[model samples]
Target: MRQQSSPHLSRGFSSYGCALALAALVALAACSKKEAAAPAPRPVVASIVHPDGQALQAGSLPGEVQARYSTPLSFRVGGKIIERRVRLGDTVKNGEIVALLDPADAQKNAASAQAQLDAAQHNLVYAQQQLERDKAQAKENLIAPAQLEQTTNAYASALAQRDQAQQQAALAKNQLQYTTLVAGHAGVITAEQADTGQNVSAGQAVYNLAWSGDVDVLCDVPESALAAFAVGQNASVTLAALPGRKFSARVRELSPAADQQSRTWRARLTLAQPGPDVRLGMTADVTPAVPLATAAAQHGLFTLPATALFHEGRQPAVWVVRAADNTLELRRVTVTRYDERTIVVSEGLKDGESVVLQGVHTVSAGEKVRAIAPLHPEDFAS
Candidate 1:
């Protein structure tokens, strides 16, 4: 009986040992499968960073060509327009008639004024004759002193009346002349507000004239780009209508206050030598150049698409590619400016360093990645 009990005990112990070993083998297989199923390196678009001077130049701002001196031509007197001599974009000389108004009313007014002046002159002459006769009678003791004084007073009153009538006549004549709308300066008619057979009030604009002198490029600049521009600063202008041509311009005026609606300041750049081809209303591009000695250039500024920026706990960072093992490293960058489509980084990056351009959020530090050029290379163009 003792021997039989020992054999059973030994078999039980062996069975328990086998069960534990089987469990260990299953756990080992599971571990191996998990390792095999691990994710591979992610493919991400990237670009090699270079110190971009054009980024510091602030790119280009859309603008329009305009005249430095634009004035609205209007009639000085109210009347019905009879004819419009100039159309839109017509060049006119100084004092050239651009439009004419119905002069019938003005003619009647002038005639009435002339008639009044003639009557006043006749009255003045009659008063002077009566005063002289009274004076002669008084000297001969045939007229009372009060009567002679009255006659002299009448003569003085008549002279004043004649002078007033003369002024009225002159004013009427000028009003008749004012019926004709003339260009105050040599300019191009940029807009025509009133045409023939239209009634316009006095001082109502009939045409918008852009003086043919200095041409300007007008652009609206946002607050972010305002620092790059200053009055009298030099810039370059390119027109879409006139392709392949670049005009030199200088900052002439910058609005002190920003526009309420657009939050942009109006900037006017005067062309140094604008040709006749640089007509008003032509679409233009204004690019302000950055000097090489600027702080941004000195610090090696780089521009990247806005997608490349990542945030780590509110701190701006980027994913840098490690060349040794094709791994990613999160690097904090000093952002100089945030534009609509790009980010300007001033520090924490070296020239020729590979940086992930897109899908920055999907990457993590120490993760292996495959770096490739962006599909749209134009997006990275300086």
Candidate 2:
């Protein structure tokens, strides 16, 4: 304004001011650049599922193996044990001799009876000849009638004596046959009840045998489960000794009374065609198959790992169910059975429900918790 300033000087001042303003704007823009994008929100989660639940059938059961027809072996007549031909665990056929009683006295008695019988027979022949001679004499008038009558009576007496002696001989022969002990059927001798040289009474048990054709299993089932089993129900059987092998059996008999000590009942089952290797007294497991008509089920069961099981008043229970509105329900569970991994719940659960399988110790009723998604359920393998 003072010198109306030279045009070049005025232009240069304006350009310098413009350059300063532009620099200030660039600085503001650098400050306005956004911070790193925030981390994605953590996914909502519920209970974690380890393994899953499978549909259960009433057909599966725990059972035991047992012999269908087992009886003690013994002799019909009493005698001193002379020899035992078979030891424990020996198989024998029907009528096969298993043992021998001391037969010294029996043989002697039989021989004596036979000699007496033979002597009686000889006497009877002589008596018959004498009686015929007397009758002929009386007819020829050489003998008195009274004398003939006496001779006839004497012959009849001799015949009676001979018959009596013959019966005695037969008795001796029967006693001799009783000295040998034989098996009644093809079976395995499970035990030796008496030893050699021991005096045994008539019908005394000597050995226990399990017959081949008739085989059955006996199990002491819990009293509560006794009603579940009925005669003629089909079942599966197994032995802990013979792993991976299962046999078929049926409930043939049920004990009417329960055991006083264990509150259990005895159930006998018939086996289907046992093999040669199947021995008596071996441990067995029998499982009764539940007919589909009687098998019942429920819905909304919560699957829990076996580890979640803990004793509550000697009964099994589980923590179950949480609501988004912060409500909790503690449920007591009846454990049907379990293997290494899972516990089968018979009560206290509904399908598609949540349970505190893990973190059971940490969780409490009515406590607020962030629920994560449950794992997928598993399918059952045949």
With a 3 Å backbone cut-off (N, CA, C), the pairs that clash in candidate 1 are: none
The residue-level lDDT of candidate 1 at 248 comes to: 93
Error of 1 at 299 (Å): 15
Give the lDDT of residue 312 in candidate 2: 53
Residue-wise C-alpha lDDT for candidate 2, range 1-382, written one tens digit per residue: 3657799998999999999999999987776654323332222223432212223333344444445677888887899998999999788999999989998888999999999999989988998999999989998999999998988888888899899999999999888988999898887887899999999998999999877677777777642354446778788888777789888877888888877765557888888866766666678766667532233322222345665665556778765555555344567877765646666576766555566545555656665555554354332211
Q: Report the lDDT of model 1 for residue 282.
A: 91
Stretches off by above 4 angstroms in model 1 are 1-58, 291-382
lDDT of 2 at 87: 93
Best by TM-score: 1
Query: After aligning candidate 1 to the native by TM-score, how far in Å is the CA of 162 from where it should be?
Result: 0.9
Instruction: Return the TM-score for each candidate structure.
Output: 0.64, 0.57
Q: After best superposition, candidate 1 residue 33: deviation in angstroms?
A: 30
